[model samples]
Target: MDLPRKLLAELLGTALLLAVVIGSGVMAERLSGGNMAVALLANTLATVGGLYVLIELFGPVSGAHFNPAVSAVMAWRGELPRTALPPYVVAQLTGAVLGAWLAHAMFDLPLLQVATRTRSGMGQWIAEGVATFGLLLVILRAPPARVAAMVAAYIGAAYWFTASTSFANPAAVVGRMVSDSFAGIAPASAPGFIVAELIGAAVALLVHPLLSPPRAAGREAASPPSSPARHV
Candidate 1:
């Protein structure tokens, strides 16, 4: 995809994600009267569902990488072209900020707080890292080899299972921090979560070569010559 189109993909994808999570989250809160577990389940499901649909909708155009961290990893994988970085990152960040503001609008109660995600301590940090790492692994493996449905299913399942509750995307984390809702991260802790996620992403990069991509003179390059594995 061209730069402009890729940029647009990021913008639209993030907006869709935020709208789904924030909108569904508000609905859940209203329905459950702010039950934390219920609210989280609703929001996480929305996120995973939205990502699945968005990927299919925009897969051809811009690779549908709504998250900058995803874009970073895709670039590393040689999936994204070099020239696409600036526009892609800008688009993703801009969409994220807009998404947060939109979420604020939906859940703006009578001086009520936003429905933000506020996990901390060692458990929270570890969860975020594991979730982020697992998430990236899922992305790399699914499309090329596995079914797209599996891609979506794994994400939803992770939401239901993981302790960190899947703070898997740095872009999502930063954007979510902008609001004070069920899905928002405390701005103060945003940096740490992102750092942990980066570390996880780094680990994914280290093992990437062994999984797939290859060839020279009719010979396969990657050791396994297989696609990425899904860990979400």
Candidate 2:
């Protein structure tokens, strides 16, 4: 696919993803009153559904990589052109911020508000690393036909299992930092999450090769590149 089209897909897909995440969080918080569990449950459901749809909608165009970590992994695997990584990351980040703004607008909240929700600490960082590692592992290992469902289901589960609610995507961290809603993470805390996620991605990359059997020589060249793991 052309670079422009691919970038556009990444941008649009990531934007819609953030909108679903932040918007659902806002709505869930409002309706759940003071019940944090209820609000989280609602947010998780919406994110799982929306994430599946976005990947299905944009997978053909850009492999629906709405996260910089995914794009980085793809490039390292030679599934994506190395030259394209910067642009893909840029698009995803831009889309994330825009998506947060869009969610605020729809809910009649102030635009560009900074998140004050602190999400820092050793346990939270560890949870983030685990969350990201599991996410990439699922993406790397799942069969193409089941990638979307597997990814969505894992994220839904991760939301409950991880202490930080699994903000596993670096682009997502940037996006959520722009909102002060229930789903948001403070900008001050974004760096730790980003670093942990990157470390998780690196660990996944190292372990991925061990999990898959090596392709026969020239076998890869003969076959078309497989579908990338859909990462929202």
Candidate 3:
């Protein structure tokens, strides 16, 4: 894929993902009368569904790494092109911030309010790692033929079960910090969340192979430049 073209696609995909998340969160709040469960279910479903489609739509070009952590993992796995990583990461974060800001504005919530919407604590932090690890593990493992489907399902379910609601993506966490709404992470707490995700991903990377297939033949040929198809 052409670097410029892929970069543009990645930017659009990230923006799209964040847009849906913010919109869904706002809608859930309005519809549920502040019911946390309702809001969370709505937000998670929309976010995961949007992500699933967005990634598929842009995967052929940009690898659909709407999250920086995913990009980092891709880099580690040799699936992403090394030189393009910096731009991809920059674009992803920028898109996330913009998306969150738009969500705040759309909901008539103050920018400052959006920036401080984080409720992170020790429990949430641990939840963050577990969710992110699961996400990365599925992306790394799988019966190559069904990787995307498996990833989307695993992510959606994890968001439902995990208390953190599975932020799962470091770039996404930072973007969330720009908003203090249902989607925001406290800027102060963002680093810890990011660190937790990295650690989780590392642990998953080490252990995932033991249970998955060793390789996927045709799958490897079409795999992203950075995501090596090492099942074993």
A best-first ranking of the candidates according to their TM-score comes to 2, 3, 1
Model 2, runs deviating above 4 Å: 214-232
Please write out the lDDT profile of model 2 over residues 68-176, one tens digit for every residue.
9999998887788899999999999999999999999999999979999999999999999999999999888877878789999999999999999998999999999
Tens digits of per-residue lDDT for model 1 on 1-232? 4567667777987777766766776677778775778887777677667777777777666666776777777666556665676677888888877776776676664323443455677777777777766667766555553534665676677676766667677777767776666566777778788888888777776665567645531343333323212211
**After best superposition, candidate 3 residue 40: deviation in angstroms?**
1.1
Give all candidate RMSDs, comma-separated. Answer: 4.4, 1.9, 3.7
Pairs in clash, predicted candidate 2: none
Candidate 1 global TM-score: 0.82
TM-score of candidate 2 against the unseen true structure = 0.94
lDDT of 2: 0.91
* Candidate 3: C-alpha RMSD after superposition: 3.7
lDDT of 3 at 90: 92
Model 1, which residues run further than 4 Å from truth? 106-117, 143-147, 212-232
Instruction: Estimate the TM-score of every prediction.
Output: 0.82, 0.94, 0.85
Clashes of 1: 8
lDDT of candidates 1 onward, in order: 0.67, 0.91, 0.74
Residue 100 in model 1: lDDT: 67
Clashes of each: 8, 0, 10
